[model samples]
Target: MSLPMTCRRSSPRLLSLCLAIAGALAAQSAIAADSSAATETSDDAAHPPASDTRHAEHAEKSKRAVDLDTVVVTASPLRTTAGDLGKPAAVLAGERLDEDRASSLGETVSSIPGVQSSNFGPGVGRPIIRGLDGPRVSVLSDGLSTEDVSTVSQDHSPAIEPFLADQIEVLKGPSTLLYGSGAIGGVVNVVDGRIPEEAIENGFGGRAEARFFGGDQDGTTDMARIDGGTDRFALHADAVYRNAKDYDTPDGVQANSFIDTKSGAVGGSLLGDWGFVGLSASRFEDGYGNPGEPGDLSAGERGVHLQLRQNRYDLKGGLKDLWGEGNGLRFSFGHTDYDHIEFEGDEPGTTFTKNANEGRVEATFGNRDAWQGAVGVQGTDSTFAAVGEESFVPQTTTRGYGAFGIARRSWGDFQLDFGARVDKVKSEPDAMASRDFTPLSLSLSGGWKLGENWRLTANLDHAERAPVEEELFANGPHIATLAYEVGDPNLDKEAANQLELGLQYKSSLVDAKVSAYYNRFKDFIYLVDTGDQWYWDEENDYLPIRQWSQSNAIFRGFEGEATFHLADNDSGRWDLRAFGDTVRATLADGGGNVPRIPPSRLGAQLRWENGDWRASLGATRVNRQDKVATNETPTAGYTMIDAHAARHFDTGNVGWELFVDGTNLTNQVGRVHTSFLKDDVELPGRSFDVGVRVFF
Candidate 1:
């Protein structure tokens, strides 16, 4: 089958992707033969000597196992596992990731403790970590900045497609030691495996999936990915498409809450004994409505909608044994062209554009048993512009350079880790004097094994973040936020001193973890309600006046999760899990509570797994939030119920999986306190998602 003529005419890139898919399908037969032969050869080579048969069996089992603690975190330059890391981290992949996947990146990972989503609507959801959002948190794609303008506004969605990700990693605390000033709060990295780091064991492999969402949301999503290559060279391609109509809320249908997205990428790599070199090109297009400003037809007002497009190119390479047997060097570069248009009715109201280039190089040395460390340098150059009626911020250019080093040492049952980073950042506006900031960050962490089943960890972090473009120069009205925003050009960099303590216990019957953290900020930047209003003659209304302000503040939080292995017998393997998180933020001088902080939440899940079938049922309770900043109203509490089930089987030489996911089963009227449009927009109503996946 081929794409329609209209699809072919829509964009050359789309046409090329369609052709690539067709080509991949046509070569499946030959690829299958090669895969079969490769598998046979591998099986024959797996035979071990009788003397080492038991050890070889154990090694084989480990190779085929997928353990969250054992998964290597690609975000870390040292390539360490989550269990070995000095700080708290979470990895979502395999069946778990598939069950948790959502349309937005924020929702996809919100289940993790200490993390939540900032929802403008169904179309826009950004990750918020430990009461921090916007510029504080860094969103990354394959360890590099996504280079999107999401931080500039609450209504903008990230340019990444979560459905295509192979694994998503969340670093829960201050990660500025590795990711720079933007990660003063933390980091979220989506690994898509677009650029293969190693050869495909099966010679050729791919997966395709199609899903439909029913109930409050009527949507369809389709995606496909293929990887093929020899020991010397490899290729990859992936594509995704999604469309959804206005979703229904408890009050009624969300008038302007629709979404449409299309994205695709192609990558290739050259592999050898030394290392690998790879390059990839990707395109993303999205169109979504702003429910906050739903227009009235009687008043001749048109609903607001946004159209976004981005093209990105990435190049990555690595060299092994550079200095010694255990030493390696890696480098990556990315260039992105991004633009978005906000439409008022049928006319374009505002246009935003960004062009950016970023690069990073790092070298790793030593071994994990004794001492290991990594040193890296990173640089970024970006230009941003806004024009048209709703333009609130002026054109600006930002340049940043940083160098960082991290080292870890272990002795017996004790481990210590330390890191430091220094950065120089400059922001130059079109007609204003440029601002420069020099920020330094340092961190120290230690972990000790208490016994065979218990462990303890502690961390101290001093991180600094430079003000972003919006925080330092934004001015005028932002319709999406319904506010007249003002900025202070003389704003200084923000600094944070944080401490964290954690404990863990693991056994055959139960696994658990708990952590507590506190942060003190010397200069915290936040949007303040000035008790003033701006009267717009065109809209004949007064908009709230908000100004960017700085003050000393403190944040404290606790997060924990535990799982109990209930039963593992003929019926199936049953596991019960419980998780909860709470955070409090307020001014150090008792000025007021921080606005838009996520409410406390407690959740539990019952999961069952068998040979080829799995299922889960869960519920979360969100507590009411009354601790609000001046002029901010309180939000009520809510309870959400969700469930999932899947069946796996094989057909001939191919594998197939059928899955169903139900969210908000009770159709709760939940309001996200962290959202700018919380009062105007309720969470989507009950929805059941049914899907089928095919593997080759």
Candidate 2:
């Protein structure tokens, strides 16, 4: 099973995540917590009960994860549990979702150290983690690859339905070494408990939530979601529709980032103690645009206009003691169909279809205090189709197969994690030549425990990727901004060899972590303009005329984070925590800075809770990055501030609660500094929402 984190735009200003999980785009904004917890599992045994689903929604009210503290198990094929993660991570839950209604999942996620957002518009956004985006990141549904358009390019959207996940997981740094080589940056997993584990006895549980917002702009959401269980069966289903008018800039300029978004979803499943099974499907449609671009005011090509649709089904089974005790295996297979079209200027509309099917399986060896390791296989079969476009792969087929291994062991006073992965990628374009390549990667980590309150961890990773449809066959006008980009048929996959060193401290009141890294790239595939008719051709493809080649480059960075928990064990006051995370990046002396890479980033937050009420204040700083590389572009810096509070009403159910939310108390101006188009493209102005949640 491969659990993926899908990011989407929230509020009128929801998140724009780079990767579908978080759909990691740029537009995503902050959303309060609506997360759940998990339990550990033995090597060969199935888990007793899984955590609740973490839905992606924005409510006016807010709360902290501690209030609903829970671990997320079965994130991947490996039998790794929350406790095994050891590294720093955060989980969001219900009330927290209510409080941060102004933005989307990507925005809320950016609050984490080393995480950033890539916005497309209010309806589309995805998260970019630790400088990783595109094919390097994986977005899965319940541990199965989403295989949707979201991973194809920045202009595309993911197929995940955020308003329904049971919980969200953010894993930063080398800790994700076990996931995949591309995860050298990090991992964000969205957990949906739609599949039941324990048989229902008789009763069923469900919740309904609806939200609306009107301000400097207009916003409305019609969402109805519910999850309940019977004596031996549990099920879940929900639907949501959203839309927003153009928002005004601080200068009162009508930023064309207006949004016309709509969505509908339906899903259900059967539960069991040994494991559960289920199916889900959704549809998303929208028209959106960007403002503040240079050049002449183009024609009808304003923003992204699409009639996007998708469908998916997953059958997963959990088994223990395949042959004996303390031994188990998890298997899942999924298929998805996604289609969308983009309209740019006089350029004809460019449409594409992404049909993908994937399978994954993992086996783990179990024994307490004994050495442990897991081996798994992942395969993806996909087709990329384009309408009226001709190039490297206007219509092509690609496949990927990978095998990975991770091991853990204890040595007297220290622990070590050593792992490696090998991916074999093969592609065949219609009427074109066939291609094949295999990438090799590895990860190594060491931990030394000094009296339990202090520790040290160091990691190293070497990962690579093959070119995607856009990098090899992208040729068309950007419907949103009216710019054309022709693809370079002979581009090669980019590779990164990186290193990281860090220190960590955790006492009765505070936790802190700091790390520094360096990465070298070879045959890097980045988009460049051909500079004619404002009509663009991928520059690096062939220098002056007919040919085939690519550009090479390097990038490096440093990141750190810390937190202080003010509430003590003796205090029934609950949570009183202060935290912050930061990242800074630079290009090699001769290399141009990567386009749209944000400069130094800083964030701070304060949270308090007493019984049923909780409040929080957050502030973020993104420095301007005018340091342009020989061929890379530069972006400006900006600051964002937000605050929220919420009160919970327990329903007496084992895991059931309700709350109201308020957001953007100041309705601060929004900007995505790292965006390629950030001039007049400000984030949503401000917003608010109310919601309810239940779990049994």
lDDT of 2: 0.55
Candidate 1, residues 131-219, lDDT tens digits: the string is: 99888999999989999999999999999999998778999888999989999999999988787776665577677777778999998
TM-score of each: 0.93, 0.80
By lDDT, the best candidate is: 1
Each model's backbone clash number: 0, 106
**What is the C-alpha lDDT profile of model 2 across 73-124, one tens digit per residue?**
4563444444334454555545554454333446556655567777765555
Give lDDT for model 1. 0.86
Supply candidate 2's per-residue lDDT for 383: 89
Q: What is the lDDT of residue 288 in candidate 1?
A: 93
